[model samples]
Target: MSAMVDTPAAQPLPRRTEGSSARIGALAPLSSPGWVEAGRHLLAGLESGVLDVNDAGGVLGRPLELVVRDTAADPQRAAAAVEELAGLGVAAVAGEYHSVVARAAAAKADALGLPFLCSSAVLDALTDRPTDWVARLAPAQSHGWRIYAEFLLGAGHRRIAVAAQPSVYWESGTRILREHLAPRCGTVIELDMGALTPEDVCDALADHGATALLLLTGIPEPAVSLVRSVRADRRLAGVLVGAPAGQPEFGPWAALLGEDGAGIPFLRYLPERLGPLGARVGSALRERLGRAPSFVAFEGYDTITVLADVLSAGELSRERIPASWAGVAVEGTRGPIRFSRVPGVGVRQWAWAPVQVVDRDPAALDRFRVLRTG
Candidate 1:
């Protein structure tokens, strides 16, 4: 049975009766067209967090419940989930891995006055305007991708090529790379995945003298195919393949590509050393996952931790949840969790989670090597 089967496709999202369990809505992509591996890790962390909270006597003397809804990587579906969850009387909403989907949920949550602590989405513009309704645990795309750009530059990759598909998230990432790199004498080359085949990408890389090729496309399809093509081509042997979206952080990427997936630096939000709390959580997550947990899992765990703290701080009412964003000071798995207004960001943002550019070590394919940190 797949992970999707373990978690039902849809669960009833009806309002909880008064004096019953306090509910929080969870959004994740747990089925096809979504990153199932990521969703499973995220949900595992969330469920674990809930279990720990309940073990500690629950939130505000009531069992804290998660009303999970599969976003399935759909923006429209995510928006509707936010509306339904709001009507279901969930105190707030949490968890979404995709940025575009989270953006939709954030907009809807803001409109409906629901506090949403976005777990994994890193899009800088999470909302249309500055609002107090949403906060994010992941570092913004600009911040993390800039670190990636610096990593590329430090490694002597000035001429970079990105094989990208059309996405608000991917497009935003491309633009950020362009703006950040142009002044620094780094040129970004765009190879549209829609127009180019894997073979054509290799040919273009050689023709353009591009030293690095970034996979801004989706997983397992063009991304896997492109890496294979680039790796096998003798003409482009020196060309480095990269996936800056952290696609390589999950198990499937390594399982599918084997050693071919190694050396593909991507962004991950984890500290160099897991502190005591993070180490414990990481161990628990690894046991629960039956494998190493991705950073998304930690994000999910921290989301519930922050929410539990806010709900326990005093006012447990829905209206006061957004007001609690500023005063949060919980120790998260990544580090201290706090929210503040970041310029150019419309949501109260955890200014950053630890950003690292890491790759699967080529010699020891199971281990990740930290290439750079920011």
Candidate 2:
């Protein structure tokens, strides 16, 4: 349980090889403050049988055994974790929560002929590379931006700008926004976070003639800055700022924004059903993280759900897996997830990405006063 443990002995999963059992691994980052809490909810689901592999006693001859590894937010460590899962005879691994880690672990999965289904990672480089041994249940970064772009167009904003730091997410934000805007918009700009002030932001806004902004940053600190700057100048007070992360805190900033941030919108993709199992996992997430985790946990939770159905169909054999996994739709928290096989990748399904308008109440200051439940 310590941070510095070596590649320990192959401690077999409890019910494995005893009869019929499939091995599934969750490659998680206990180090990430946001995602690790999500992992805990997923763990609770796995432990409680909310994600039942038995599938009403008709899917497979075996139940699933979940193995877990802490990537600790290190990419090399993530790769090593995949190798360990391969050695443990795990049939598949959930690549870590970031694209770099997913890409690293994917190489091992491809070489060893194991399936690596992505959960939370959203780097575009992930899908750009063609591989059969890897596929993701979650949307690629491009998909995320695509959803955000559609949201913008629907809201009638043509000029777009991104406020961001130069991290991996920012790099992805630049690429996705460029692709989404180039074909359809008249003006697009990206403001770097190297250092910024109200005047600098206003100057950028003026250059683009922006009526709306797409805040690439997850939090609205940059959006707040924009509001303060625009308000002081009085000319730009009504400009809109929207967030894709759907964070609630953007609510209070609306007051500073006048009308810009209050009714301002956000985006998310979610499951369509409650099934027999969802609440169990959702509650576990709340217990562990003190709040509901995001689509990331749903991705991890759904990975198990699909595998459970597949394993419940027959004995744990590679040949039997294809029939079980192919094109099967999982009614997960993120709606329906299906899989397709690429030449080098094992089996992966294209995900349906959706965008919705989240109403934030400034009176409540970003708390979920009422969830529209799209």
Candidate 3:
């Protein structure tokens, strides 16, 4: 896909028929370079959301339809998808797990005056300036990472090392961890994964006397290697390994690493317990996904739930949807869904979705144990 072109004027809503569907543009990273497992779970939730909505009579008695696009984790592809979706007269846009890609999509959607409810992107600034055109369901990186930092402190890790790849998203996360930990007498050691090997990272942890090493690198390559190297190092045997970016939330991380993957903490947006609505949604999502649903999947379901509420509130015009964000109050699978302006975030945020520090249990690699919550 190409880069986003000049902003187009807001297109009129498509003509409705009694049998015609209400279209929503769905974006996901379904190919390489993107987290394909995360995308599959996200799409399952999105598709499941549409199914539930249609079963409930959909928006204004029209079936809710998803115009799915594979972003492949490219910002250019995502931006272009937004333009195409806007031109297609989609009532709104939703779903993107990658923060950078979501930023591109959000910017394009904002420019095109297309209302977008972001599903799982947690970057603090989804847009450069505040815009009613975009809103997000996931807690901001600052919010969630701060919680993870707290978890680290409570776990007695005052010195931490981050093996990070270069990216705006990773940089922001590192910054969040550093800033949050600094005032509390904690130190953050930066290991540039671009210049260092996984063995080098393990050596750094031993030399720096850091008690925790967070994986801020991409999955299956540096991240997987770093985990293996650190776990194998006798000098760093007691060191805590974490991935605050939620890499361990999906199946592939466990599938590849097996017992080696267990006990590595990560951030997840979910409550301690699910309500009746959540239980039903979880069961349906499990059936659709052929496995347990990650928090990203629930984020997808909630994205459509919020959008459906906005569309059903009154008029289904594109212009009307942005305004409806403030008025939104619906029961999402996670919890009560509402949007409000959060400090440092440009888009209307869910205030917070439930945040947890979780890791797969060593005794049972398939099960997750909640280590902390915020």
- Best candidate according to TM-score: 3
Backbone clashes in model 3, listed as residue pairs: none
Estimate every model's Cα lDDT from 0 to 1: 0.89, 0.59, 0.90
RMSD of each: 6.3, 7.2, 3.4
Q: Point out the higher-scoring one by TM-score: 2 or 3.
A: 3
Which of 1 and 3 is the better model by lDDT?
A: 3
Task: Please count the clashing residue pairs in each candidate, in the order shown.
Answer: 0, 20, 0
Candidate 3 stretches greater than 4 Å from native: 1-9
Clashes of 1: 0
- Give one digit per residue, the lDDT tens place, for model 3 in 1-374: 11223434566887877678889999999999999998998898899899999999888888899999999999999999999998898999999999999999999998988988889999998888778888899999999999999999999999999999999999999998889999999999999999999888888889999999999988999898998998899999899999999999888899999999999999999999999988999999888888889998898998889989998874678877777888999999999999888777888889889999999999998899999999
Off by over 4 Å in 1: 1-19
Q: What's model 1's TM-score?
A: 0.95
Candidates 2 and 3 compared by lDDT, better number: 3
Tell me the TM-score of model 3.
0.97
- Model 2 whole-model lDDT (C-alpha atoms): 0.59
What is the alpha-carbon lDDT for the whole of candidate 3? 0.90
Write one digit per residue (lDDT tens) for candidate 1, span 14-110: 5545668888999999987998899999999999899889999888788889999999999999999998888887888999999999999988887
